[model samples]
Target: MTGRDHDHVTRVMRTVSCDASAARSRLAASWQRSFAHHRLDPAAAPPQDRDTTRLAEQEEMLGRLLHVASPRLDELFSTIGQSGHGVFMTDARGLILRARQRAADEADFIRSGLVAGGDWSEEAQGTNGIGTCLAEKRPLIIHRDQHYLARNIAMSCIDAPVFDHEGTLIAALDVSSPRAESDGFNQLIGAMVSGIASKIEIDLFRDIHSDRQIVLVGDDRAGTALLAVDRDGLVVGATRSARIGCGLARQGALRPVPLRDVLGETSEGLSGAEKAALTRALARANGNVSAAARALGIGRATLYRRMKRLGISGAD
Candidate 1:
């Protein structure tokens, strides 16, 4: 390397090391781990492609993610293609499920094995857009020199997460393109990618909870988050937004909890939705209060008192 280029690399490395020590940013943590744990050399060209899943395995991976993502991929590709960006979808593990780019852009991606069946997890690629986004569980942009590998330093990547009906991070949607010195368009690209990811997540939620009442949750801070409330007014399922905005995230994946808890609303105020839920449960249980109460996710005694207040009459 020229003396000037070598000095710049040394400066960036020292800065990253200090950033890693301070733990001030997710990007720093990822870079530290890449260098410390994965033994990647930021100054060197990227390592060779890691082992990819076989064709048959790729089919299985596609089968799981495609239905939920298929309806929107074409439209997203059209938009991104028009803007000269290549888009890719990856499963939770960062295995590429699908990718699209203009013919010119497509060639290099394929040559680099950034195609379907490729694994781009953090451990494999070291601080890439798709890998780092998954590691952080939030959408982000990884631009140019931010990439751990020298080979990827010419590309900028934008990625967003996709959650299932239960609020599990099931997919990552990403866009990649050549980075210019002063493109000044990462935010616009991030917004577009985020919108597409949100649509895919909501589509999956609606399909999974077609029989339930889906309510919009966040507005003030979260913008638009969706949740499904049962007849008892208990939260049954939630979109990624609702989970984040309403603070309904469980320890693991999606778990149903009472709406009163999630919304912080008074029990009396929830009577309408709760009563309707009880009515449906009672009808389904053939007027059995015991079964209805159980279905309502409440104690029989609690259900009885609630029914009394609501003037709901049903046989025990």
Candidate 2:
């Protein structure tokens, strides 16, 4: 190795060998994991290209998510592509499935193993952005030298985890730049990447639960506060944030709980609630009384009687 490369690896080893409590920062903790848990060598050569067949299989498994996340990936690239940034999306395993980079900067990213089919899992690449974010299940920025590997110290990586409708982590969105940048600039880019990831999650959730009533429960800055309610006003699904924040089921089939019960409401509000539910169902059905009635688990005649009692009109 070159003198500079050797020095970088030496520093990484020293940091990782320090006392556990002394390395309390996230970067330090990741370094510890890289050295102890993963047993990675910071000075090791870059990973080999994954086989085409394996990549195709991973792509097929994530086909639905790729379709939902394509536009958002384009949007993110448009925002940062010209600034020497490469946008990447990885499956839950940290295998990059798709990437968008300017033609001029493509070779550099490829050499650094930032292209599609590259495995950036924490176990594979140590304390890098895409892998570490997926490992921790949160948004993060691995700025330049924060990367455990000396070969990756020149690139800044920002990433965020993408969860599905049921709040299970499904993928990660990342933006990486080889150009030197200020910490403030990296923070701004990190937020943008995180926002795009959240948008992808929201789109995926809506696509999966299109037939249900989607309710925004709280601040959605993280885009996890979504609940899917059925026509009978039962919450059938919840996003990760909603599940944790609202105390709902975390896994498997969610128990059919009344929306009002989940929202901590009383029976005194039943009339108003029923009217609102009917209106929403009708709107979703495009004023088709039979369809809306079916969605609400009621007969067409019963729905018409309730609509009349509630003074709702505009139905055929």
TM-score of each candidate structure, all chains considered together: 0.76, 0.85
lDDT of model 2, residue 114? 88
Error of 1 at 241 (Å): 2.3
lDDT of 2 by residue, 120-209 (tens): 999999999999999899899998888998889889999999988777888999999899999899999988998898889888888989
For residues 113-183, write the lDDT of model 1, one tens digit per residue. Answer: 57877777788777899998988889999987777765666678899998777777888999888736344
**Pairs in steric clash, model 1:** 231-277
Task: Give the whole-model CA lDDT for all candidates, comma-separated.
Answer: 0.76, 0.88
lDDT, candidate 1, at 41: 72
Question: In candidate 2, what residue range of length 10 has the lowest lDDT sum?
Answer: 16-25
> Deviation in angstroms for 249 in model 2?
2.7
